[model samples]
Target: MKIVVGSKNPAKIRAVKDVFNECKVSSKDVPSDVSNQPYSDQETRQGAINRAKACIGIGEIESFGIGLEGGVMYIGKQLYLCNWGALVTPDEKIYTASGARIPLPKSISDELQLGKELGDVIDVFTKKKDVRQNEGTIGIFTNALVTRQEMFSHVVRLLKGQWEFAYKN
Candidate 1:
């Protein structure tokens, strides 16, 4: 099957490609239609769903759309890094899933609380440019044990598995 991923972000595209190696996959820059820094799981998941839903009729190929969104959420009082993924088929059947969450260091969480996006804060924290396009905050926090691609891939797998179970007989 052909798949059209909702974002051109390398890690997200790589997750889809890696997880769906047999399919013809392509990506487009679709709007998540949410705040640049999604503050809760609900918003993050909605961003993914919106992006996926936005990908319909974008290209000539009959394809499914997959979206991956990363953001932070406050659990109790501590903010944690979180991510979600969504997939939408041509028929508009949607599947969604969330990935792991890890507590942020107070220093980073404080920066986020200051209204800075995680991607921007991470760049300054790691002193690297475009960390989000590379390993992402998950990589730095987890010491590279869980890369951005790996995390999104887990979510994509869940979405794909759910779709398969629901649609494939």
Candidate 2:
């Protein structure tokens, strides 16, 4: 079976590719139809589902569409990073899973509260360009003990595992 990722982001694509190594995985530019920085788990999971559904059957090939989304949410007064993933089969069966979350530093949370995207805020925070495409804020916060790719991969694994359990035939 073929697999397609909804975004061209290397980190997201790599997670799908790495987890579904036995399958042919590719990437497409699909819209998530959500805010640049989703501020809640519901919106973040919706974004992932949107992307996953949008990427189905590209080039008329039977495929699995995978979507990875990163967002931030507040649990009380603290803001935290949240990640979600979705897998959509050619038949439109949907499976979703959430991944690691870490609290954001006040400085970054301040920027997010200002309506700035975490990608842009993280770039400013790290004095680096395209940090989201790399290790992401999770990497910087955890000192690379965990990475954006790994977090997404964890979600993908959960998605696939759930799908398998539901439709193991």
Candidate 3:
């Protein structure tokens, strides 16, 4: 099986590869068609869905399209990081799952409030360039206990489980 990921970001691509070990995975750059910094769970999930749907049928090959998007959510008075993944199967079946959430420090939340992408803000705050390409925010917060790729991989597995369950029952 061939899997097409909506974004060429390393973390997203790696997550798909980790979860779909038996498949041939490839990635393409696609627009999420959402805000650079999605600020709500609904918007984040929509971004992933849009990307996955947009990438479907591209290259004229049979493939499953996957999209991964990370954003922030505000709950009560605290801000948290959220990630979502969407999968579009060859038969047009759609499945989605969410990754873990981590509360953001006030300093980072302040920067995000000014309309900055989480990746960029994280890069600046962590003093690391393109952290998303490496360990990512999850790695930083968890002290490498959980990486961004790992988080997304879990979501992909959850989506696959949903698909499997639906097909079996």
Model 2 C-alpha lDDT per residue in residues 1-169, reported as the tens digit of each score: 8898999999999899889999988889999999998999999999999999998988656888888999998999999999999999999999999999899999999988899999999999999999999998999999999999999999999998999899866
lDDT score, candidate 3, position 9: 92
Task: For residue 117, give model 3's deviation from the true position in Å.
Answer: 1.3
TM-score of 1: 0.97
State each candidate's clash count: 0, 0, 0
Tens digits of per-residue lDDT for model 3, 1-169: 7889999899889988998989888888999999998999999999999888877888756888899999999899999999998998878889999999999999989988887888998899899999988888888999999999999999999887997798899
Looking at model 2, the pairs that clash are: none
Compute the lDDT of residue 162 as modeled in candidate 2: 93
Model 2 TM-score is 0.97
Candidate 3 vs. truth: CA RMSD?
Answer: 1.1
Per-residue lDDT tens digits for candidate 1, residues 37-117, read: 999999999999999988877774467989899999999999999999999988898899999999999999898889889
Task: Give the Cα-based TM-score of candidate 3 against the true structure.
Answer: 0.96
Ranking by TM-score: 2, 1, 3
